[model samples]
Target chain A: MTEKDFELAGIRTVEEQPLRAKRKWYKEYPVVSMLFLGIMIVECFFCEQIMTVNPTYMDLEHCNVAPGRKFLFGTDTLGRDIFSMIWYGGRVSLLIGFVATAISTAIGVLFGAVSGVASPRADAFLMRAVEIVLSIPNLLMIVLLQAVLGGAGVIGISIVIGITGWMSIAKVVRTEVRQIRNSEYVIASKCMGGSFWHILWRHFLPNFWPSIMFMVVMNVRTAIVAESTLSFMGIGLPLEIVSWGSMLALSQQALMTGSWWMILIPGCFLIVTLMCVTDIGNSLRRDSNQRQSNL
Target chain B: MSEILIDVQNVTHHFKLNRKTAICAVDQVSFQIKKGEILGLVGESGAGKSTLARCIMNLYQPTAGRILYKGIDTCDRRQFKEHKKMLQTKRQLIFQDSTSSINQRMKAVDIIAEPLRINHVHTPRGSARAEAEFQLHYVGMDAGCLDKYPPELSGGERQRIAIARALSMEPELLVADEPIASLDVSIQAQIINLFKHLQKEHGFTFLFISHDLAMVEYLCDRVGVMYQGRLVELAPTRDLFSNPQHPYTRTLLSAIPLPDPKRERNRRKGVYDAQKS
Candidate 1:
C-alpha cells in the first residue's frame, strides 16, 4: 500500500490513449437516399430550364413517337415530351407529398399530445375514436373522401389524403407520448409547476420527436401513393393540370395504342422516389430504436 | 422545541389493480418533521418508503387522510391552487435515479436554472445562470460542467448535478427518496457528507429516505423505521441506535455488518416472525 512497496512492485503509469469517437457512418446517415432525393428535388426545381420542349404542347405530327434522340423518352399519345412531363409533373407530385405530410403530421401530433395528457376516461374515448378511424382501410377512406371533395385540384387531393393518413401517425405519436409522459423528467417538470404547453415544448417534444419522425416520412410516401392510386383510377386531379398522377391517368389511351414508354417511364420515377423515401424512414426508425435501447 | 414543518396525519395510499383488487402501499402512516432537521426513513424494498415519500411530495393524492405543509392542506385542490407558487418553490424532490430524474437533452446549467425559470423567481444573484453557477459551486462542482449534458457525465457527476438543481431553488424542505441508493459506496459517503454539511450550513428541513441503516444513523437527526407499509419505530438517531423499540427495528439494526472480522464471525443475524409479532 505504501510508495516504497509500489516502487518495489515496479508499477508505472501508461499515458492514456484517447478513443476516437466511433462515427456510425452508415446507420446514422442514409447518404444514398439523401443524395437521390436531393437530385430528384433539384431536377424538379429546374424543370423549366431542363426541358427541351413544352411539357403540355401537343404535336399531331409526332403522335405515338418512339423514344429517340430527337424526343427523349419519346412523345406520348398526344405528342407531349415524356421527359419534360416527368420533370414538370415531379414538382406537383413532390409538392403534394410534402404539403399532405405536413398537414397530417401536424394534426397527428396535436391529437396524440392531447390524448396523452388527457384524463384516463378522455384518453380512452379519444383512442377509441382513432381506432374506429383506423379500422377502415386507408386507401378506401382517401378515395371516398376524394370523391366527396370532387377532386377539384392538387390542394383538394392533398387535403383528402392528409385527413385520411393522420390516423396511423396519431396512434404512433399517442403511444410515444404516453410513454414519455411517465418519464421522471416530465413529472419533475410538472412538479416544478411548468404549464402544459411549456412541458410539451421543452420536455415532451425532445423525448418523442425521433419516434414521430419515422412515421412522418412514411406518411409522405403514403400520401404520394394515395395521389397516384386515385389518379390511376381516373378520379384524381383533372388531366389539364399536369402531375405524375395525371400523367399516368392519361396513359390509358397510350396503353391501347401500345406506346409502352408512357406507362414505363412515370412508373419507374414514382417507384424510385418511393423507395428512397422508405429507406430514409427505415434509417430514422432504426436510429430511434437504438436510442431507446441505449436508454 | 422546533416548529413542525410537515405534518402527515394517518395518510394512506392504495393502488387499484382492478375492480376487485387493490394494493395498500402506505397504511395510515403518520409522522412529523420539524424545521431544520434531517429525518431519515429506512425500510426494505417494497416497504412503501417511496410511496410515502411521493405522497408527502404531493405527487400522489393519498387515498385517505391528508398532509399539511406549514398549516396548508396540500391535498385540497383550491388550497393548492391558492398557494401553488409558494408550494412549488418552497419544496423540491431528489429522486433515486439521477439518470431519469434529470433531462438528458438539457445542459447542467439549464437543468439547474429550470425551476427558477418556471417559478419566475427573480435571481438576486444577477442572472439565473449566475445563480445556477453559484449552486453548482455550492454543491462542490466546478463551472466546467456548466455546458455538459447528463449523458456525458459520470454517475457521481450526474447525481451532483441533480443535487445542484434541487438546491438551486433553495427550498425549505427537500425530500430525497433513496438519493444514494444508486450510487457507489465511496460516492454515497461523499454525498452523505455533503448533505450533512449542507444541512448544517443552510438550516433547511430534509426528508432523506434510504435503506442503508448505517447511513441513517450517521447522518440523520432522527430515524423512522418502516416494515410492510407500517411505521415500526420512530426515535432520535442516538436513541434509535442505542435502543430500538420494535422487533423489526432490532432485526434491521442487527443486519448492519460490522468491519471487525473476529466480532463479525460471532455476529448473529436476527429474523422477524410476523405471526408471533
Candidate 2:
C-alpha cells in the first residue's frame, strides 16, 4: 500500500483488504503433477476397457518382440502384452500405495497423539517401543511375516508394509504434537474446557497435516519399491497377479535375452509415479509454509 | 467486608530446573479479592506477577499452599474435578500477549465463542456467534471484524477479541495478565478505559496484573506491590501511592516518570540494594 492510500483510509479499511489476489486452483497447485496423477488414476481405473489384449495372454509365436506397432510397450519373453501389464499392474501398485499409506498414517497419528499427551513415563515407554521397532530392518521382518502367513496377496503385503512403516511417522507425529501442545492457543483451548479429541480435531490435525502428507507420499514411494524388491526376489504376489513388480520379476531372462524394454518400461512407470507424488507433496508443504508465514 | 470471591492463601510456585535446584517464581503470597472489586498487582519485570496470575487461574499447580474460589479449594484435584464446569465457566483469563493467546487460524467470532461452545453454555441471544458479537460490541469492537483472523487485526483489536472471548462466559472472576503491554500507548488508554467500564457495568471481580503503575493507580480499587515474587505492600490505590510503606514500593513509585518537564527534572530516583536487603 502507498502512503497516500493509507492517508485516505482508516486502520479498519486497511485491515479489510484481501490478503492476496485470488487465483484459480490450477494456478495454486502443481498442475503437471496433478494432471499426471489424475491421468494415472483414470487410466488404471479403466484398465479392462482400455486393454485390447489380456495382460497374461502369452503368444508363443511372437517372443521377445521389440517396440512395434502391434504392441504398445512391446512383448515380454512370455509374449504377454507389456502395455496391458503396465495398466493392469498400475491398478495394484496405486491401490497398494494408497491403502498402505492410509493404514500407516492412521496408526502413526494415533500413536503420536497418544504418546504426545501421555505422562512422562508413558511417553518414554511408547517412544522406546517405537525406537526398537525402527531399529529392526523392515524388509527382513516383512519376509518373515509373509512366510508365517503361508502366502501373500495385495492386502497382505499392504498390511505388512503398513505395520512396519508406521514407526518413523509415529516419531514425526510425536514431535509435532509435543511442540503444538505447549502453544498458547492450545493451552487456551484446554483452559476453556475443550476435550482432547476436540483439541486434536480443531488444532492438532490442521497444523500438522502438511507434514503428514509429505510423509505419506514418501511412504508410497517406499512401498512401491519394497513391493518391486520382493517380487524380483520371487517372494511377492503370486504369478497370477500382474502388478508392475510382477512384470519386472522376469528381468533376469530379459537381461540374458537382451530385451531391455521388459525391464526399462516398467521401471520408467514406477519412477514417473514416484516423481509425481514427490512433486505434489513438495507443493503441499510449500503452500502450508507460505500460509503460516503470511499469517 | 464483602464476600471474598477469590482467596489465595500462602501460594508458592517453583519450577524445578534439575535435581539439584529450583527457581521459586511465586513466594508464599496470600490475598483476597472481594466481590465486584478490582485488585491491581504492580511490579517490575520478573517479579512473578504473571506467574502469580497463572497460579490463580489454575494454569500452574502451586508447589505449596492453596487457592479457594467461592469456598471451594481449587488447588485440590478432587474439588476441582467436582466443580469443573463452574470453575471453567466462571473464571476466565486474558493472557499477556494477544498474538499468542488467540489461535491465529480461527476467526474472531470463533475465538470468542470457543469457551461458550466448549462449556455448552446457552446464551440468551440464541447462538454462540450472537453472544460473541454482543461481547465484541461490549468491548467496543465493531462486528465487521468478527470474521477476520487474529493476524488481520491490529494488536489492540486482537486484545479486544481476547477480552471479548473472556467476557463471553460472563466470568465472575477475570484475570488479565499485562493485557495491554504489547499495544500502542494510545490503544493502551482505550483498553484501560474499556476495562474500567466493564468492571463498573458488570460488577465483575478483576485481578489485573500490569507493569504500568499509572494505569493500575487509575483503574484499581486495591493495589498490591510485588517485589521479587513477594507482595511487599497491599493497600488501597491512593494510600499505597501516597504513603508507601515498603522501601521497594517507594522505589517503584519513584520510577514512574512525570509528565511535567520541571517536576521530571527535579524528581529524585529511589534505589534499594537487593544484596543489603
Candidate 3:
C-alpha cells in the first residue's frame, strides 16, 4: 500500500490462481437426493439383471392371483407378475424419456446458441422456424407420423417425441444466450481482447449451463408423459414389451373386472418418476437463481 | 517539455436512441493527455463522461475524428481486427461496477488472470496464480479472497479484483470511468489513494473520470469538465480551481460543500441545469 508496506510485503504482480477445490454433488445433496437416487439405481440394477422372473413371461397357474409371497403386486389376467411388469415397464419408459430429452436438448441448444449469436436476419429466420415447429400440434403430429411408420420401434418413437419437443427448449436457450451475449461481462471480455468464440465458450456456456440442466430435466418429464400418451393410443412401443402406457392401456378393460392393481401399480411408478424429475429440475433452477440474488 | 501520450482530434460518437433519431453521446470532444499525467474527466451521470472514456478505450469506434495513442492511430478503421488487437492490451478501462463487469461464474483469481492469460503474459497455470495473488496484494486484497466468486465478495473487493485484472496487463494507459462510483464514500477515498499510488509507481497515463470535483482536484494533474457530451473546459487542477472560466465549471465548483456550515452558507449560488442545453 505504501513504500514502507511494499518493503515489508515483497510482492508485486498478481498471478493467475488455479480453480478452487469444488465439492461433489453427492456431498451437496447428501440426505434426500442421495438416498432417493441410490434406491432408484439399486432397483434399476435389480430389475435389469438380478431379477429371475421375466416381466413378459406368463404363467397360467398365477392367473387371478393377488399380492402374496410369490408376486408382490399380484398377477394380471394373462398371469404376469405385476411387480416385474411395473419394473420393466418403468425401465423402458424412463429410458425413452432420457433418450428423447438428450436428442431434443442437443438439437435445441445448438440451434439456440447459433441463432442467439448469429446475425439479426439469421436469428429472425431461425426463430420463425421454431415458431412454425411449435405451431404444429405435438401429440397429433407424433401420432400421425408414427401411424405412417406403423409398428415403429422404441428408437423411432423416441426420435418422434424428441422432434416435437425441442421447439420450446430452443426458444429458451436462444433467449438466454442472447441475454448473456449482451451482458456487461461479455463486453468486458471483448475489451480484454478475448475472441468471440472464447467468450461464448468460456463465459456464456458456463453461465447458461444451469438453465440448460433445468430444461433437460423438465424435457425428460415432458418426454415421458408424451411417450405414455402415444403408447396409451397403442401407437408407441411394441406390444411384446411392457411399458407404463401399454399397461395402462391393457388395464382399461381390466378396470371393468375390478383388478385395480393392474392399473394402479404401473401408474404409481409413472407418477413418482415424473415427480422426481420435476423436483430435481426445481432444485436446479433454485440453485442457479440463488447464486444471483442470495447472499 | 511533457510529450503528448494521447491525442484526440474531435472524437464524436453517436448512438441510435431509437429508430428515428440518433443522439450524439460524445459531441466532437477533443482533449490531450500528457505522458505519466493523470487527466480527470468530470461530469454528471449522463454528461457522456463514460462514453468519452469508452471512446478513448476504443471500445466504441468514434463516429468521426481520430484518437492517437503514443502516435499510433488507435481509432484507425483500417485492418479493423488487427488494429484493435494491437491496442487492446496497451490501453485498458476499469468499469464502475465490477459485479456487472466481472464474469459472475469466475473466481477472483481467474478474473485477475484473464487479461494476463489472454495477452500471453503468463501461460503457465502456476505463474498465473502467483501473478493473480500478487495483484490482489497490490490492490490491498488478501490471498484468501482469491478463490471467491464476485457474488461471494463485497462490492469493494470485486472492484479491487477488477482493478487488479486491468493492472495485470501492465498497461501503458488506464481509463478508469467512475471506478469508485458504486463504492461506499469511505472506501472511495481509499480507492482514489490506491489509484494515485499505482499511478505514481506504474507511471502510466491515467484518465480518472468522476463527478467528484474535489476528488479530481486531489488526484488529477489536469481536469476536463464535460457537459452534455461536450468538453467545455480543460486546465491544470490548480488553475481550474483558482481561476474557473466556464459557467458550468464555476457552478460545479460552487456546488462542493465545505465542512464549516458558515463557509457552506456563504458558498456561491449557481445551479447549472444540464438539461437546458
Q: Please, what is the TM-score per model?
A: 0.84, 0.85, 0.78
lDDT for each candidate structure = 0.89, 0.89, 0.84
Off by over 4 Å in 2: A1-29, A48-85, A116-125, A250-264, A285-295, B121-131, B273-277
lDDT per residue for candidate 1 within B108-219, as digits (tens), equals 9889999988888898798998998999999889999999989889888888888888888888999999999999999999999999989888888999999999899899
Compare candidates 1 and 2 on TM-score and give the better one: 2
lDDT of model 2, residue A111: 94
Question: What CA root-mean-square deviation does each model show from the true structure?
Answer: 6.4, 6.8, 11.1
Q: What overall lDDT, based on C-alpha atoms, would model 1 receive against the true structure?
A: 0.89
Per-residue alpha-carbon lDDT of model 2 for B1-277, expressed as tens digits? Answer: 3999999999999989999999998999999999999999999999999999888878999999899999999999999999998988899899889999887778999999988888888999998888988999999988999999888999999999999999988989999999999999999999999999998888889999999999999999999988888888999999999999989889999998999999999999999877776
**Fnat computed for model 1:** 0.55
Clashes in candidate 2: how many? 0
Error of 2 at A81 (Å): 5.1
Compare the candidates by DockQ and give the number of the best one.
Answer: 1
RMSD of 2: 6.8
A72: Cα error in model 3, Å: 5.2
Sort order, DockQ high to low: 1, 2, 3
**Model 2 lDDT, residue A83, Cα:** 91
Off by over 4 Å in 3: A1-38, A45-49, A53-89, A106-128, A144-157, A172-183, A194-215, A239-264, A280-295, B1-5, B18-20, B69-78, B103-106, B116-128, B242-251, B254-277
